[model samples]
Target: MKSLNDIKNIAIILTLAYAGITVTFLTYMATSVRTYNEIITYKEHEINLAFGYLFLIGMFTLVVLLLFLFYRAITISNRLLQQADRASGNYTIVESVELDKERRANEEKMREAKLLFDKEVESKLTAMLIFSPENLAEDTAFLEAIMLKMAKEFSAVQGLAYKYNKTNKAFELAATYAYFSENVKQSFTLDEGIPGQVAVKKESLKINNVPQGYLTVLSGLGKGTPSALYVIPIVVDSETVALLELAFFNNIDELLQQVVEQLEPKLGNIYAKFLK
Candidate 1:
């Protein structure tokens, strides 16, 4: 296809050629009329003058027509260039939008896959705990194992299991996993902090924000506050047997929360037998 530049170049060359031809023809006619007027008879001079006037008129009209055609060509080329630029810009914008949509779709698929994997792991762990030998639930070592498993599975920064002390009328810390604090209280009354409250109410609570000075999370890096907390009460036979506390640097999502909730009933049965 001929480009706009090629067409413009052709139009310019034609216009210049027409102008040159017009100038050359006028010069030739003027010189011829001057020579004829000096050499020819008066009657012949008059007749030649009439012919020269007609030829001059015709050449002028032709020059005007060529100039008009050249101007029209330039105008058409400019319009075509503008349209091409606009089309190119629109194509770029559309391509960018399509890429963004594809990126978002890929991210969504990854998120869904991660959720499914987590759910499967949680289900398997629940079945394992439920079907274990009856002797495992009666030993202190089993309580520690359960705490460790819960902390690892949930990615908790710290985990504490508090068995209800009937003699002392308090919840005593029975097991700890990934915990770095020695200053923590050994036990809590039924009305004390969030854990105590969950034990009294016999309901689970998910806290997205922990108040300042309420709790401090310790790690090898340093000590800092946790962003979220979970207080779950283990109940069996209409009585609270133990309370489980978990702390994390990030907020827990709904899928993990649902898994934890499902595990509570089975844990309640195990803890009841172990605490006895």
Candidate 2:
């Protein structure tokens, strides 16, 4: 059904038609009364009655003209209504097409996201299932070998080692490998810096910013390039003994966190090895 506005327009056209009709009737009656009065006067020239009849004819003709014009206007309005309806339908079709395209685009994006998530899960699983303890020996040597293997596989940039020093209440460097150079300080003590902080707290440390000073305090592993570092400790018999540190290039960030998470469990039974 059409809205009230359309009905209102129709009502207005009806009212105008009524008004035109009323005017036409009033003009015809006025002309008849005037013609009668002029004919009754009987004085003056015959010219008066002739003129009055001509005026009456002209008024009647005008009423017909007005009705014809009104009819033409109604037809024009109907054509406009049809044009408007077609435009509205065209707009609706276009909107529906756009909605369908958007739905397909969103579905494609979701599929890609799921595939990426699955790939990452597979990568972590591969890293964790290296070897079962029943199939391999549980020794520090073996652990180190595993670490090395994983590092290579993961494209690790450096391997670091630290041992807690109860005597100085610090962690002392036991072994270190710097991929970039042989000249990197092969050893460091807790008194030296951040590695010590990790040792003192018995908590892992991950530094996102290798400030200029910390960068200068040591160099070579990632050079000034390691913007992030992870420190994990080796614990034995409820006492902290050693630490493992890895520095990554630029932002091996999320990957490093995953590596550390995977590394922690493997050290569960043999943490005693690095204490010596």
Error of 2 at 14 (Å): 30
Model 2 scores worst on lDDT over the 10 consecutive residues at 214-223
**Model 1 lDDT at residue 33:** 42
Instruction: Report the C-alpha lDDT of model 1 over 129-168, residue by residue, as the tens digit.
Output: 7435643846455666666665666667777888887899
- Model 2 segments more than 4 A misplaced: 1-122, 125-147, 165-169, 179-192, 213-224, 273-276
**Candidate 1 has which clashing residue pairs, if any?**
none
RMSD of candidate 2 to the true fold? Answer: 12.9
Which one is best on TM-score? 1
Question: What C-alpha lDDT values do all the predictions have?
Answer: 0.74, 0.60
Clashing pairs in 2: none
TM-score for each of the candidates: 0.53, 0.45
Number of clashing residue pairs in every model? 0, 0
Lowest-lDDT window of 10 residues in candidate 1?
33-42
